[model samples]
Target chain A: MNKTTNQDPVVVRNPTPSWRAILLCVLASMGSAAWAGTPLRVCYVDDRSGVAADTGIQSFNGFQIAVSEINDAGGINGQKVEVVSYDGKTDPQLTATFASRCAEDDGALAIVGGNPSAPAAAMIPVASEYEIPYLMLSAGTDNLTDMPAPFHFRVGPRNAQDAAAIAELIARQGFKRVALINNSLPFGTDSAHATEAALKTSGVPVVIQQTYDINATDLSPQIGRLRSANPDVIVVFPYAADGARVLRTLQQQGISLPRIVARSALLNTLRELAGDASDGVLVPNTVDMQRPDVKKFFDSYKTRFGEAQPTMYPVLGYDAAKMFLQAIADPAVQKALAADELADARVAIRDALIRNGNYQGLQGHAGATYQFGPDRHHGPPDQNWFVFVQVADKGKHLVAADLATFKPGS
Target chain B: MKSLNTARSMLAGPALILLVGALVPLLLTSGFHLRLVTIICIYTILCTGFNLLYGYAGQISMGQQGFFALGAYAFTLLMSAGNWSFWSALPAALLICAGVALLIGIPLLRLRSHYLAMATLCFGLVFAGIASRWIEFTGGTAGMMVPSVKFSGHIVSRTELYYAILLIMVLVLVMQNFIVSTHMGRALMSLRGDETAAQSLGVNVTAWKLRIFILSSVLAGLAGIASAVVNRQVNPSFSEFPILVSILTIAVVGGLGTRYGALLGACVVVIAPQGLAAFGESETIIYGVCLLLFLMFMPHGLSGLIPKLFGRIRRKAASPAPGVVKAGEIKP
Candidate 1:
């Protein structure tokens, strides 16, 4: 009984399939294999599940819209464009990891979307290492273009450009003394430096430059100092959340003065957070919502995402995606891809994008035009992208303002 | 016979670890997974040092990430700006980190409990602020790129880096084992249990605590230098709040007092999140739930529960049936 229990069962191997069956299997597989050309894979790395998820989600939506539109109207060189997205969680390490995976595993033709400067900077070396074109969406740090990043391109307005625009506006208004308040992050410091340089060059005296913590809820001390300085204008460089806090604090302390903010301060969330306190604030926005092209894009974005109101981030995403798509659609790039030469195609696309001059984009609505050269990777180098707007109607509307229309001490 | 058994037990754990480490690369094909394993090894080094300080020495350090950032920045600055080779810069960075740790620990180790935590937290915040604000030196939060690690006239590949980190981890493990078996280790453990009583028993509490603190920070610095070499970049964000939270969480979940706890904790903290990354936004929620469950049921941690389980199994195996006569005992 032990032997019987321990004995293995007799092995029975089934005979191989007949030639007829094999033939049928092969034919069936052949019939089921639909011949759709190889997809043009692109990677979208962003903060999909962290504090910056709002911007990431909007950017994803905008990229999706662009992808769908391109696929609907024939894809690049008759190949469907597929997106492989990875959530970076706003972690620089994770973002770098995703960049490598996208380049190595996903075989992405290009990479896009690192909303914050940290992740954007992190993506630079990885993209350069992999020799893939990286289209940065929202990060506007000036250092991104300071070094020679051959394969990197930025679509958003840089801190230097916006500060220069504000300085020009200040100079045109003939403001004698200006007070600057900024957050203590890189964005704030860079903007402060730029504004200071521009103001110095324009012969306008900067009376005080104060900085607060990134997420400080109270700005009374900073506001009090600014009020004491008693400059003709106060320029603030902060994100929407902190900007709202600053605005509300200013209103609470009854320190009323001409205030101006960076593009990020124009967000609807700022208005909602600060409520009526956001009124009478001036913002330098890079996109004009009043333009017909921008309106059409907004309508389509709303239709797709079911969002009645869209923010500036999504438009930036749309422009970045559009620029990449335009590069891929170039005849030289298409020819390289057709030859199945991926590396060549990447190089060709980079060259084509660099050579692209005076290119009008969706952001052109705000007088923003993209021009890239071998030496210049950041788009719209000048202050042509900036438009000053006054927040009014309890922050429900933005009315365009011209510095030329106002007197110095009005 | 006792010496033989001791030798076997001592060799068994490391042999098993060596086997696993050897097999991991063969099993995992993706470069990303390999890189992640390297990261886990680096974190293991950091957590082990943290365990020595917090678990055995009874000091709470909330600013291990600050040391890590210091090491990374020091190494990068030396390599890039000073044009020093990685081989020389690495030791220099570690030494700088040790000196800084000594300066901080001398004053800081005097504080107890939450006050120490707050002090360390402030140090971390100040480190981050300096890294971001000192633009001329630290690149002002845009971060500085590190040169590729070169040794023997060849650039280190990802696999080679992974193995290098693994070798360092093994050496750390051996050192940790040696430390735990010594009288100093007993003194530290005693200090953790009852500080005043340990002092009455002739244990130099402050000296031991400060020494462990410095050692822990040096380990963090080493890990940081390794990280900079691997990533080829260093930034102010390296010392951010999330990294501190991760170190603390790894220490707590890995079984604070055990020798193998840091390794277990590092694996769970680093690899578990990557595994749950497929769930997208809910990854954080699921991770939180898992941590909560672990803390509720296995409060002492995964390493702490192992002995209890093994003892129960051994007792069952060793027990005799009822009414059976023993060789040396008379029946009742």
Candidate 2:
């Protein structure tokens, strides 16, 4: 006789399956299968770790939340929008891996993100190879915008364009002498160049230009040297962490100029982190806290996540998802677009976005919608939205018109 | 008798596990998942190379990343900028990497322990600085274009790259296994256990150490080239040491002497972080905690743990057969 064991599959007397269990299994199977008419998959890659993780992750989270909402609201053309998210960790190799996976396996209809330029630069050729629509969410390099790739689109201002807007504003203010402090990274270099061009156009003279590594701890020496220039205004270009260091040093050094301004790094958590130092500083920002669209977004953000407001990053991320889904909604596009012909959809969506110019985004809501053509893939128009704001007990408030309205060197 | 039974049991578990791994890829259809697996294999090759030197030889070389950066950069820069064919560029890259290993080894190998580690670490930092600063040649910090790797006429895609890496890793593993099992392998192990004693035994210690050092460096260089070819780009950032690579030497923490322990250790270090990344970025904290746990409980590592667990089982099973020679046992 065979000895009974626990490992043995003992036959148990049972009744027929319950209708509920049967229904649940059926539902689970259906859930696992990709719905036949699903909308195209698009991958949004960003730095999910490292120093960039602090801000870059917000971009991805915003995009994911928006994409989920879009699907819940009934997807693009009744087809669900899916995104295969991957962490770039601010590294180019990791970016390439995620991008390739999306192109090869996910059958991605498009790809979006380039919050940091180094990885984004690596991704450009891959997007070109797969011919998929690649949306640039925050890479403000003039190089990208100056010569547009066939399927590239930018949702934010290029450095030169943003600087030009500042130039226009600064020209009106009639300031004639300015000093520039910039980071060593490409972003800072380009911003300085653009600011120089704008300043030259506005007839504001640049007194001194200083450069420092983003990780530099001592800015007192640089500030001491720059203060010797004795310019009317000082323009600083660095990320939030670096900028805070610079601001604190400047404050401690006891040097005060007519105006202190910065590039985009002065936004978001950087602004919050700067605390009192953030007050009385003018930075280039498209998001007018007063705009109706932006106010709604801010309210929803605070209510949903219990924050005061979303920053330019989250706003851009939400817009990137909106822009991608809008493309998926086009009739010619679908889940089954061949990989080779993927760029066609990208071009189509890019063109649609460019023409749908002046449509409000979360930040630059009232700004002219993005318009694209054969020669241009940069979003909206080349104009400045840099409103000079004062940080106070209430919150950051616009105290002056766009920086473009002031004379450079002010 | 107990030791013989314990050894049999240890071999059986790993043998089963490896057999499962070898078969799983064949069953899976998703090219994406296969591509991920291929990446793991490439990293395994890299970690294995590090293990040989760090684990078996008791050397700490942080410049393995520098060699990797060199291989990828040299290959990509040659192919894209120089317009060389993939075949020609690959050999050129290998030769250059081996040449670097030779030049670096002469001075670097003379140092011992932390000094050697620090020296190698400095090399990696300097290499990264050069890659970023030498904008004219290395694409500065932005990175250089990696021309598509072509075999025959077809430009290799992700799918093809995965297979290529797989074939290369398998070949490398087999060669490594063969070397570690030979007389030379025993000599290295002897040196690791006691250098003075090993030399006393006429093992030609210096020559063996130099050979393994160069061999390990070449493997790292080749792995870098493979990664560059697969990813289609290389930048200065590639040289930054992942905390994982350091823990990868934990392969020795377990198999510190055995090749299998090195592999098992590498998988735990590499794959665990990746799986945990899904939970949050705090996965790093978890990795640190796990490493601490392993150090505290299983000092000899997963490799050492295996034999002990099996030995206990064999002790229970063979109580009745104390005087009986096991079928697998040979008279020593």
Candidate 3:
């Protein structure tokens, strides 16, 4: 018997389908597992199935374009990016489940979603629980600010900050009498209340305050009611789509005031959807129109998305993704960060952003900043550097006035 | 003979289900999945309670989500306001829900199926409205957080919350079993099938309806509490009228008239999203399609499918025809 001593394959006629076969099988299994580990691993969950689903879809598309750019640039750390998007269905419970699933199973390092306040409120704890940063693209609630998490960061200004900026603008425009028209949503109600109160404190009295449903098409009655008040300035606090509709309604009603100031929330979909109606309407926004950074952003956005005009949400989505990238790319993070301590990289990124007063974002702005600490969960106080922009020449929205233009308590 | 054998197998179903469910978290090794399972368990408890009313009692109530939301909000308010321990706050939430159920049931139970459904649906919408508008009390639309429920001094993690939810669900199930096995269960079932007939047989239909309504509300409230703790946050949207939940109960998705159908139904509805999301936002399109398919083909839901499948397998295994297949064909 010419048996191989310890090899033991000598007795087997077929030799277990050859060693080459076994090696291939082992290698194949490992290769399959490694393949599972790749794919950009991005997540998009939004209230995309509910009343605001259409706008949510637009916001998600913007984030998709950002991810597309990353992949086109050879992806992060040499791995390709794959986005796993789900609908929160405008439901909070569903959003929480989706957020947790991404963090725990999909190994998603960051998230972008929660167009509505209700869903974002539910997901705040999930972000903390999973120890992954969530960049809320549309949610404007300061609720997340109350309970600080190193992992939670938002690209836009907080509601209170927006309210303060709008108040400052009202003071600058020299509009003493303003009418606040808000939607029935939390954002509208709070913005209306905050803006009204802040303006009141700043010695500007709101002539009329009215609320309407965002889902309603005929804002004619609401507009008519507000028109009766006939204030010099009208501050509309409806969300993107509805806000756009309301702006068109006001224009149709021939109700353009001497000064039209809108919350940044209104500008979310205003420029494109509202068309010429959005022109000449002043908006207090974090977008810095003067900087080369802002110009680069518009050019990049236009090249990638084929639309030069960027919605507030897509701008936010792009900012958040890049911010996440910057956080994870720190040198100390590369040297000392372990798999378990990966969240610290996000923390480092947030800290760097807070310290950076001049973050050259995709948009042409260096003033967009972030601030975080154990006591302060809110973004930078200096993030209040909102510029008053006018929709110039129908197609372009340009900076009408910078923060330096507005004197304090003007 | 087949029915008898099937009954024997069903007697073993709960144990098998529990065994599998208990092992899922360990097997998955993903903290996210564990949290998802915890959510599934929370819904299982709630929909199970609704099952007792709609499936067994023949009542259609849309207000279960209201109870759920109320429980969560109540628990949040109580725990945060008083800095009360979670152990204390949970029972308080249940009692508050039960009390609200009693108050609302007095007027709501007076209405019949569709009217009852509408009324309960209104309650859910109203609760959402209050949560949105009444910012002072309910944290308004921004929502308020319920501090992480603590045990000793350590904050509970999502994994720990999952186990806590599982234990509560098991307890609710055990209690459900105890109730269903007794006279009250038979009486409630009779009322569901025919309140007039039950009344003719000397059953206090109204009283029984009120009792079941209140009991169901209490359980739903408990589920809400479990959900809030597990999710580590409370918002009005947690219970923004679970229309699908109500539909699942009476639709025979789980076996109609079978209490355990609630569990199967919840599993189907809840697990579908995680699996379907791979197809994208059109996952909702899938949900609608599945609803259509279930409505047309499997009217009795998973409950009907389960029994028929098991019976077929047992019949084939014990007495196989020439062309018949072997055992394990029927799933439990």
Candidate 4:
């Protein structure tokens, strides 16, 4: 056997490629190009299984719909876009862990969706650490963009901007004394601070300020304090469930003051939970669904989700995905990608977003337009991005308030 | 010869654990895995403390996460607002946690079993509530950024953090071994078995319980500060129900009375989720099933089953020819 091995050296030295092998190699490359296009992997992190599952699932549905739509449209530059989603469970640590895995292990080019502010803020360090772009979908907290977050861009309006807009609406409505009730969470606290600052600037005195725990079932004491203050209007900052609880408590106390709430309170779930109490409650409207484009998108969303109507959360997700896709589709970004400079392409995508100021989106109908710049990471530069809507007809309808009738300076 | 064998047996578990832990960085170079292992080390410290209280002292603390959150916030506040060094903030955080634990344990540890559990549960809720509501100091629900642990004019990298946390955990394990081998450990063990009987046996039951409680809280505080420094962030949710659940689950899964159980449990609890992460939403269901199976079959936990299995295997190997007697052996 040793003699045979020594004598077979010439046999092992070189084997020229046969015609069959050449054919096989050609066929393999052709099959690869035909069957599997190069995929652009992006990571979607959200709270899909825990406390925030409801909103998280909705945001994911919107994201999935956008992914399908983009893929259906031949994908970005004909490269199939794939999303690797990880359920963050609304835990910041878990979110950070998954974000790191997504960037480091999965080689995800971008990350999107941190529905709540805490997880969104958690993703900032991860984004900076990994040098990947993160798009904020539903988290409206200002702290996300307050610092120098180079790779972070937000599609949602900032809490401060929304609060200031609501304050202006209050001023326009001639409600001099406004009482504020906010959830103790960051979103609510930040909104409360912004409202207080805006109200102070507008010379509208805040009669009372109270806060309730995020999931407080009984807000009677808080409502009682608000009622005793006897303000002309009460502005509340909470999500759907807590906002409904507050409205129900106020109704039980027979307090008839005009109530204004953040956009989150306008959710369909809140209307269902609050029942008749939600009627006449004012909410900031960032998207006019009546617009043709928005109506078309809403109809498609309802059809896709098999529902009668879609909520603002899904729309926020849809817009966020679209914005990311559009940014990546920019000629400069595509050029970088084609050149195989992935890091440069990521940076180019971010710069493209910043350069393309005032990009019209589905939210534009309601004066909320997506824009980004070196100084402005938050979307929707329009300060009056929100108009007021009053729930009417036993919480079944939302009618636009007459903001045009009252002069802003008057 | 017996003494040498006994010494080998005693050092085997820790030596194996240290070898495994030391091999992690060499095996995986990704920051993700490094962070995960660092977190596991922190959890090991926490579980060791938890086992000391729940497994040895017979106390159920549903509020350990409350102590954890306190330590995190205390460290962050001291470092940022008070401008304290990492070394200074760490001890301060642990000291504060120990002092608070003493005061609360004095009144709270008087209750037994489920009542004690309920009280601790309430403590956790109240801690989370206070942290979330006190926006001025705690940053409320938005959470606060933690400064990096700086040493010798240089920020500690992830690799350095791994070693630092590993050193602390090793020291904790050694201390735990010392405690378990000593009379204080026996007193705590007796308390776990029967508090009334232990009291009758001249054991200062209440004092022992409180001492263990303080020690456990300090360990938890140390773990929390380490976590804050490693993650570079702190939030109210750190003390919420999920964290409490994690602490309790790891302790129960690791084994009750064993010293190495804490380390074993930390590995399972921390690594299992990440390993099963590919299952997505169904991951929680699968994890629940795994825990249920472990509890139903291995009631003493994974660590508790090791010795019994090993003893059986050794016995079988030694008596390979049971029916045949050797020349020097007497047949029965």
- How much of the real interface does each model capture, measured as fnat? 0.21, 0.15, 0.43, 0.26
DockQ of each: 0.25, 0.21, 0.32, 0.25
Tell me the spans in candidate 3 whose CA falls farther than 4 Å from its real position: A1-85, A214-224, A240-284, A288-290, A337-358, A362-377, A380-384, A387-410, B1-13, B154-160, B241-252, B314-332
* Local error of candidate 3 at residue B65 (angstroms): 1.4
Q: How do the residues A302-332 of candidate 2 rate in per-residue lDDT, one tens digit apiece?
A: 6555564335667777787887776566655
Q: Which ten residues in a row have the lowest lDDT in candidate 1 chain A?
A: A1-10
lDDT of 4 by residue, A16-119 (tens): 11112112333222221111123676788888887567667777777767777887778877776777777888878778878877766556678888877778
- Tens digit per residue, CA lDDT, model 3, A1-410: 11122231111111011112112333222211121344435566787778667556666656656666666677667655566666788777778878876665555656777767777767778887766667676576766657556566555667777788888777866776788888887778888888887897899888888899879988998889888986777888877778778878988999866434455433435566777777666676556656675667667666655654434555666666666556555565444244445456445545554454244454324644555444555543544456666665562554455434333233
Q: What is the interface RMSD, in angstroms, for predicted model 3?
A: 13.0
Output the worst ten-in-a-row residue range by lDDT, candidate 4 chain A: A8-17
Candidate 1's residue-wise lDDT over A54-100, tens digit each?
77888778787787778777776677677767778778877887787
Q: What does the lDDT read for residue A121 in candidate 1?
A: 83
Q: For model 3, how does the per-residue alpha-carbon lDDT over B107-214 read when each residue is reduced to its tens digit?
A: 989899899999988888788788887877887776777787778889877666777677777767666765676677789899888889999998999999999899
Give lDDT: candidate 1, residue B121.
Answer: 82
Clashing pairs counted in every model: 0, 22, 15, 0
Task: List the candidates ranked by TM-score, beginning with the highest.
Answer: 1, 4, 3, 2
Interface RMSD over true interface Cα atoms for each candidate: 15.0, 12.7, 13.0, 15.4
- Global CA lDDT of candidate 4, please? 0.77
